[model samples]
Target: MRVVVIIPSRYGSSRFDGKPLAPICGRPMVQWVYQRASQSSRVETVHVATDDERIRAAVKAFGGNVMMTASTCRSGTDRVAEAAERLGLGMRDVVVNIQGDQPLVDPRCFNAVVKPFTEDPSVKMSTLAFAIVDEREITDPKDVKVTFDENGDALYFSRATIPMGRDGFSGYTIYKHLGVYAYTREFLECFRSLSPGRLEEIEKLEQLRAMEHGHRIRVVVTPYDSPEVDLPVDIRRIEEKMAAMGIG
Candidate 1:
């Protein structure tokens, strides 16, 4: 099965406009994400899906592949689906959606996300989750939490702490959801056709739509932490991380 990585980028953002173009260590944030994704040994192709001319130009300037999507895409997933359709990918192929803001995303995580599909044919969708090291992050709305079944299938995703910690946060492992996702081309088309679910609307987490529709989302536990750039202030933090990692 072919594994394609699609990074959805837009120049407009309520928090940080033109975020994809923001420079980090002399490269645009989108380039950093694209470069890291390109290092994934499992990925056959990496493309930046965007509607903005500036973003397209930047991706081209870096000699990266890019596809123009409609500006009216409801979500990043929608943009990815559009790009995959335009590319004429087969239904059995895997399409990975990597967030453009994640400049420091681990390339190995790409391999991990696609493992479920290789090991089990039943896995139509898969995502990564990390053990919450900081207790404070459990309550933070910005950091989404996920609860999985005994089989490692996601039960629910929420902005609030899940499982309620009825025992006072002991004997339970809380997982923080990572933004990375891999979906079969068939399932991705099905996903876009489904209307928003009530739980998804309430939590504002789109992944819940699949669960609400009775589709199982395999949750892969990853040790890597995804540092996303949400605002301008986050640039320094990412740059510091790059410096510590000896990245030029």
Candidate 2:
């Protein structure tokens, strides 16, 4: 099965417009995401899926592959699904959806998400979650939380602090959901057919829709923390982090 990485980018954003073209340390943010995803040994090819001509041109100018998707696509995942359909990938082929906003995503995280499929052919969908080491993140609504079953399948995902910690926090760990995901082409099609769930609508998390529909989402614990650029102010912090890591 071939492993293809698709980064869904749009020029429009309520918080930061034209975010894909925003420069960070000389290179556009989307370029950084594309370059980092290309470093993964498991990914066969990386493509940027965008509806905007500016984003397509920027990606092409950087010598990266670009796929034009429909502007009506609601979310990044929808754009990825359309792109995968256009590519005519096999049902078993793996598709990794890496968010364009996450410029600090670790290359190893890609390998981690793909491992579940390699080990078990029955695994249809998988995602990455990191241990919540920072206490501030536990209360931060921006840091989405996930709780999985003993089998490592995600039970629920929410923006609020889960498991309530009412009994005092000990022996349990709170995991912050990362924006990366991996799925088979078949599952992607299945996901598209499902309607939004009540919990998903309440939490505003798309992943919850899959869980609400009784689909199993394997949660892979990753050590790396991927900070996404949601606002224009986040660029400076990402640039500083990149510089500290000796990345240009």
Candidate 3:
């Protein structure tokens, strides 16, 4: 099956306005994300799905493929679904939804998210999760926690800490959810048709809709932590990290 990476970028963001156009070094933030996604060997094609003409123009200026989606789309996943349909993607093709705000996302993370489906055809969708090493993060509502079964298929995802082990249960793991997602074209269409779930509404995580509907989400853990840019102060940290890694 052919794999395509679709990055959904909207100019308006509640926390950081015009985030996709934000400058990271010499290029816009979206460019960095597009470049990184393109580096993934598993992804056969990359497309940026955006509502703003400015974002479309910027992507085109960089010689990146872009699809103009309807502004009414509520979420990035929805935008990707529209793009996939517009592009005439087949049911067997895999669509990787790469977040536009994550400029530092490694190509390997994209690979990790999609690798499982190749091994098991039953894996309809998947995402990345990292262990929360910091104790402070365990209690942070902003950090979405996840727990999976022995087979590495996700059982649940919540903004609240999961597997609330009692009586000093130390060995149990706490994982923070990563925004990246890889889904078959068929599942994405199905996802758009389904209504939001209870835990999803409470946690405000759209992915939960999959779990609520009995769809299994395979979890892949990544070594590198991709910090999302939410505020202006985060730019310095991303710049520092990029500089340290010799990435311009």
Using lDDT, give the best candidate's number. 1
* Ranking of models by lDDT: 1, 2, 3
Clashing residue pairs in candidate 2 are none
Worst 10 residues of 2 by lDDT: 163-172
Better of 1 and 3 by lDDT: 1
**Model 2 error, position 159 (Å):** 0.4
Candidate 3: which pairs clash?
A: none
lDDT (10s digit) by residue, model 3, range 170-228 = 88768988889999999999999989899888889999999999899999999867778
lDDT of 2 by residue, 154-231 (tens): 988889898678786677889999999999999999998899999989989999989899999999999999998989
Candidate 2 TM-score, true structure as reference: 0.97
Report, for every candidate in turn, its global Cα lDDT versus the true structure: 0.95, 0.93, 0.90
lDDT computed for candidate 2: 0.93
Candidate 1 on 60-169: residue-level lDDT in tens? Answer: 99999999999899999999999999999999999999889999999999999999999999999999999999899888899999999988999899999987866788
Per-model TM values vs. the true structure: 0.97, 0.97, 0.95
Regions of candidate 1 where Cα sits further than 4 Å from its true position: none
